[model samples]
Target chain A: MVAIAIARQTVREALRRRVFWIFLIVAVFLIGLGPVLGFLTPKESQTIMRSLGLAVILLAGLFITIVTCIYLIPVEIERRTIYTVLSKPVQRFEFVLGKFLGGFAIVFLSIAAMGAVFLALVYFQGTTRGPDAGVLVWLTSGKFPKEMVLGVVLTFFQMMLLAALTIFFSTFATPVLNFFMSFGIFIVGNLSSVTESLTTSKNGLTSAIGKIIHYMLPNFGNFNVQNAIIHPTTEISNQGVFIRNNIIYALIYSAVLLILAVIIFDRREV
Target chain B: MATVIKKYPFETVRRRMSLLPAVLAGLGLAAFMQGQIDPDAKQFHPKDNFGKTANGGLNNEFLLLPLLGFREAAAGLLWVRCDEFFHSGDYDAILPLVRLITWLDPHAENVYITGAWHLAYNFTDANERSDRRYIAPSQSLLEEGVENNFDIPDIKFELGWQRYDKIKDFKGAEEAFKLAVATKVNKNSDDFPYGAPLKTLHILAHTYEKQGRIPEALEEWKLAIARSEEMLARSPKDYSAKSLHEAEVRNYAENIQRFNNRYSTTGHDSVNPSPYPEVLEPPPGSADKTPRSWDVAFKPELRIVRPKVFKVGGQFNSQDGARIDVRITDWNYQDRKITGTLNDFSVDPAQTILIDSISVRKNHFEREMDMSKDPKMYSFSQDFYRVVLSYNPRTTAPHLLDRFGWSGEGMTDAEKSHVFMDTDPDRTGTAYIEGQGAVPPVWDGKTVPFTNHSQPLRLIKVTYKISREQIMNQKPISENDIVSVQ
Candidate 1:
C-alpha cells in the first residue's frame, strides 16, 4: 500500500515537470506533421505516414523514459525530499520499485498517446492515396491491425526496460551522468548483434570477450518489430513464440535491474 | 559500538545476498536467450556488405542515429535517389546506391530484381559502342541476387536473359534458364504467369540451337510444346500459350525436316562419291587402266557479270588465255579508289589457274595468261574458267559505296556488277567473274558447237564431262589450284 502511494506520488511529481509537457507537445507535433511530410511523397504516402508515426512514437517514449527517470531520484535527494520519504514507513525496496513503476506508467501513457496520433495519421494518409489504402480502409471500417498494436505494445515494454535502467542509475549517479550512461546502454544494447556475431569467431580471446558482452548487455533489437508492421511480408511466422520470449526477457531484465537499485538505495546515505 | 557495527555489517550482507539468486537466474536466462536467438536470427542478416565498409564494418554514423532502426526509411530514401539517377541517365551512379539499399533491406525482393534489371538491360544497352565492359558486371550482379533470393524465379530468369541476349553466352544462359524453371516448378506461385515458364523454355531451346546442339534443342522444343499444350488445356483462352504452342509445333516440324535432310539419303554423302575410293585407284602405269576422258558439250562464249557501280569486261583470247579488263570511268570521288589482285581464277571443275595481281584502273586494264604454261589449266574435253577479284577501298572516306552512285536498293543487273562495294567501309568486297571457252581437244573426236551468253552479277555455269580414266590421271586437284582456259 505504501509502495502504491509512492508510485502515485512519483507519477504526480513527473507530470508536474516541464520536461513531460515539452516531450508531449513535441511528440504530438511530430505525429501531426506526419501528414504534411507524407505529402512530399505522393506515391508512398502510406509508407511515409507509417514510418513517421512509428518513429515519433518511439522517440517520444525514449525521451519520456530517459528525461523523467534520470532525474527522479537525484532531484528527490537534492531537494531533501528523500529525507521526508525515508522518514515514512516505506521500505527502501518499495521506494525503488514504486519509482520504477511510476516512471514506467508515465512512459506507457506517453507512448499510448503518441501511438493513437500515429494510427490516426496512418488512417488519414491511407484514405488519401497509396497502395495500402485498401488495407487501411479495411482496418478503419472494422478490422484492426493486431500486428501494429503488438508493435506498440512491444515498444512500450522496451521503454519500460529503459525506465528501469535509468532509475537504477539515478539511485547512485548524478542526473547528467545517468543520462549519458542510459543513452550509451541503449546504443550498445540495440547493436548487441554486432558483438554477438563476433562471438562466433574461432579465435578464443575475441570469442570469449564477445560472449561476455553479449550475455551481459540487453538485446534491445529483439523488440523492434516495426519493420514487420510496415512490411507485412516480413512478419514473424511464430508471433506467439516471439512475443512470449520478449515478455519473459523484459520481465527478467527489469526485475534484476530494479533489485540492484533497491539494494543500492537501501545502503546509501540520504 | 563493536556489537552494533558487526550487526549492521551482517544485515547489509544479508540484504545484498538476498538478490544473488535472482541475478544468477537473470544471467542464466540471458545466456539461454542468446543461444536460442543467434542461429535462427542469422537468416535476417543482409547477405552482402554493400553499404558497409570494405571489411564488412557498419557505418557508425548511421548506426548511431535512432533512424537507422527504421530500415524502410533508409531504403525508401535510397530508392528515391536511384530514381533520380535513373532519370538522369546516370546508370553508373545508381549501382552502388541500389546495392546499398538492397543491403539495408535484403528482404525487399523487388529491389534486387529492379537493380539487376537496371544493370543488365539499361547499363548494357547504354554501352552501345560494343564496349562490353559492363556485361560481366551486370551478369555478376544478377547472379549475386539469385544467390541471395533463391526463391525468386524472376531474378533467375532475368539472369538468363542477360546471359542470352547481352553476353551471348549460350551455356551460361542454358544453366540460368534451367535453374529458373526448376525454381518456378518448386515454388508454383499463382502470380507467375504461364507465359513466363514457356518463354524461358523457348529461349533455352533457342540457345541450344545456337550452340549447334541440334538434338538437344529438338528435345527442349518438344518439352516446350508439351508444357504449352498443358497450359492451353488448363486455360483455353490463353492466347500466349496458344501462340507458343503453335510456334513450337512449327519449330518441331522444321527441326525434323532439317534433321532428315542433314542425315538421310539427300545428305552430302549420297550426292557425292567418296574421294577415298577414287584416290585408291591404281596409278597410270598400273595394270588397272581405264579411259578417263569423256566429251561434254557446253557453250564456250558464255559470260557472267556482276553489275555494280563500276563496269568490267572480259574476253577469251584463244592465242593466249582468258583475259578480264576492269574499268571505272564514273569515279567522281577522288578520296577513294578500289584496288586488289584477282588471286583465285579457276578453269573447269576445280582448278585455280591465275594466281596473279590484276589492278582495277580508271580505264581498261587487261590480263591475258598463257594456259599452256601450266598443263593443269586445260581439260581434255572442255574448258571453263572463273576469276575472283578482291577489292579494297583505299580511302578513309565514309559512305564510299553511297558516294559512288550506288543505290543500296533497286539495282539493275548492270548496276549490280558496278556497285560491288559493301556498305561497311571497313570490310573488303569480292566480285566473281566466270566464263567458258572451247579448249582445243587433246584427245577428242569432234568439237561441240556452242553459243555465248552474257549476264551481269550472275555465276557463270560451266558444263563438262570426263571419263573415269582422265579423272584418275589428272594432276592432283585442290580447291587452291588455279587454272585458266582459252
Candidate 2:
C-alpha cells in the first residue's frame, strides 16, 4: 500500500513536469507530418510513413523516458520527500521500485498514445494507396502494416528498460550526471551490431571486450523491429518466440537494475 | 579490532548473491535475442567511408538518422533528389545516387526500375540517339536489383522489359520473365500477397511468341489463364482484382484458342509451318541427301578513321534483308559469354564492351561509328580488342525473320553458317532428330538445360582481332585484319 501510494505520487509529480509533454507533443507532430512529407517518394511513401512513425516514437520515447525517470529519485530527495516517505513505513526497495514503476507508466502511456496515432496514420495511408485491392482484405492484414504493433510494443519495452536504467542511476547520481551516464549507455547499447561484429573480431582483446559489453548492455538494438515491420515481406523465422524472449529479457534486466538500486539506496546516507 | 568478526555478515553476502541468478538469466536472454535479432543498426556503424567512411562504404554520422530506423524515409528523400537530377537532364549524376538510394532502402523497387529506365533511355548522344553504351550499366543495375529483391517480380519484370525493348534480346527477356513468373507474393505477395503477379505469366507468353516457341507460348497462355482463374476463384466477389484478372483470362483464353487453331493442328508441331527443309542423308544418290546451301557470301570490312572511331562496311547478298551486330570487347569476352545459357543483364565493369547493330541496305552497309565520346563507357585501354561482326536469325531484320525460322532453318552461308540440333533426351549430344526438324537449336541462348556449352550461334559471324594501336591510329587499318571465326 505504501509503495502504491508513492508510485501514485511519483506519477502525479512526473506529469506536472513540462518536458514530458514537450517530447510527446513533438513526437505526435512528427508522426502526423509523416504523411505530408511522404509526397517526396510517391511509390515508397507508405513505407516511409510507417518507418518514420516508429522512428519518431522511439526518438520521443527516448527523451521522455530519460527526462521523466532521471529526475524521479533525485527531486524527491532534494525536496526531502524521500524522508517523509521513508518515515511513513515505506521500505527503501518499495520506494525505488515505486519510482521505477511510476516512470515506466509514464513512458508506456506516452508511447501508447503515439502508437495509436501512428497506426491511424498508417491505416489511412495504406487504405488510400490501393484502388483495386479491397480495403477489407487490406485491413485484415494485406496492406495494413499490422506488424507495426510489434514494432511499437518492442519500442515501448526498449524505452521501459531505459527508464529502469535511469531510475537506478538517479538512486545515487545527480539528475544531470545521471542523464549523461544513462544516455551514454543507451547509445553504446544501440550499437549492438557493432558490438556483435567485434565479438567475432580477429583482435583477441577487442573480441573479449566486445563479448563483455554485448552481454552486459541493455541491448536497445534487439527491440528494433523497424526493418521487419516496414518490409512485411521480410520473414522472421519464429516471430512469436523472438518477441517473447525479448520481453522476458527486458523484464529480468529491469528487475536486476531495480534490485541493485535498492541495495545501494539502502546503504546510502540520506 | 574485532568489528570484522560480526556474525551477521554471512547474511549480507548471501543477500547480495541472491540477485545473481536473475542477472545471469537476463544476460543469457540478452545474448540469445542479440544473436537472433540481426539488428539493422549495422548500416549506421559500417567500417568504412571515403573519409571517416569509405566510398560505397558508409559510416557518416549525419547518416545516423537512417541508422536509427529511418532508412526508408532517407531513401525516399534521396530518390526525390534523384528525380530532380532526372528532370534537370543531369543524367550523369543519377547512377551514383541510385546506388545510394538502393543501399538506403533495397525494397524501393521503383528506384531500381526508374533508375534503370533512365540509364537505358535518357542518356543520349548529340543527335538524341540513346548512347547504347549505357545499356550494359542499366542491365547490371537491374540484375543487382533482382538479386537484392528476389521475392518480388517488379525488378525481374523491369529486367525483362529492358531485355525486350532496349537490348532486343528476346531470349534474355523470356528467361527474365520466366524467373519473374516463378516469384510469388507470399512469394509474390508484394501486390497479391498469395501469388506471383499474373502479368509475369502474360509477358512470358508474349516473349515465348517472340521466340517462335508457339507450343510453349500456348502453355504459358494456358498457365496464365489458370492463374487468373485461380485468383478469380479466390475472390469471386472482389470485382476489382477479379475484373482486372478477368480481362486477362479472356485474352489468354482467346490466345490459347488461336494457338490451338494455328500451331496445334498437328499435336507434335513445335512451330507453325514446320521450320524444316529436307537435309537429306548422304548415300551418294539417296533422296535424304544434304541439300545444297545458299551463299549470302558475307564479306565484312572495317577501317579506323581516327582515334576512337571506325568505319565498318559489310556486304550481304540479301538487300535490306539482314542486320549486323557489330561488337567490340575487352580482349577475351566470348570466353566469358559462352557460359550462362540466358544472355542476362550482367555486365562486368572490369571489362570494356560496346555493341551496336546496323542494317544491310542494297547488299552493303557503310557507317562510321564514333566512340570518341563516352570514354568512360568504352575505355579501350586493353592491348588487343576483338571486333565481332555477326548476324543471327532471331534478332536480325524483319526480312530475315520471314525467311529463316527460329533455328535458322531456311538460311545458310557457305563460309559462316553452322546448324546444330539436340539429338537425345539430354542435350549433351547434338544431331538432328529424324522427323522433328529445326524447331530447336543447339543453342538459341536458352533450351539446353546444362550450364557449360559452346555457342554455335552465329550464322554469319566474323571476328577480327585488332590491336588497340590500330584503334588509337598508331597502326594503320588493312583488309588483312579480318580474322575468320572458325
* Chain A TM-score vs. truth, each candidate: 0.90, 0.93
- C-alpha TM-score for every candidate: 0.59, 0.77
RMSD of 2: 7.2
lDDT of candidate 1 over B248-311, digit per residue (tens) = 9998776554333322223223322322212121233656554121111111221212111112
**Per-model DockQ against the true two-chain complex:** 0.16, 0.36
- Which segments of model 2 are wrong by more than 4 Å? A38-43, A126-144, A197-208, B1-56, B112-148, B156-179, B184-195, B203-218, B232-322, B329-352, B360-366, B378-385, B397-399, B414-458, B465-478
Q: Give the candidate number with the greatest DockQ.
A: 2
Write candidate 2's Cα lDDT for A150-252 as tens digits: 8899999999999999998988899999989998898788767667878998999999999888877888767776755576555555677778777876887
Question: Compared with the true structure, what per-residue lDDT tens digits does model 1 show for residues A38-133?
Answer: 434454454555655676677788888999999888988899777677666667777788898898889888988888777666656654334555
Docking class of 1: incorrect
Model 2 C-alpha lDDT per residue in residues B243-360, reported as the tens digit of each score: 6677666766654443332222232233333322322112235576453334567877888889978898868766485788788776665323322111233334355676677888
Q: Which TM-score value belongs to model 1?
A: 0.59
True contacts reproduced, candidate 1: 0.19
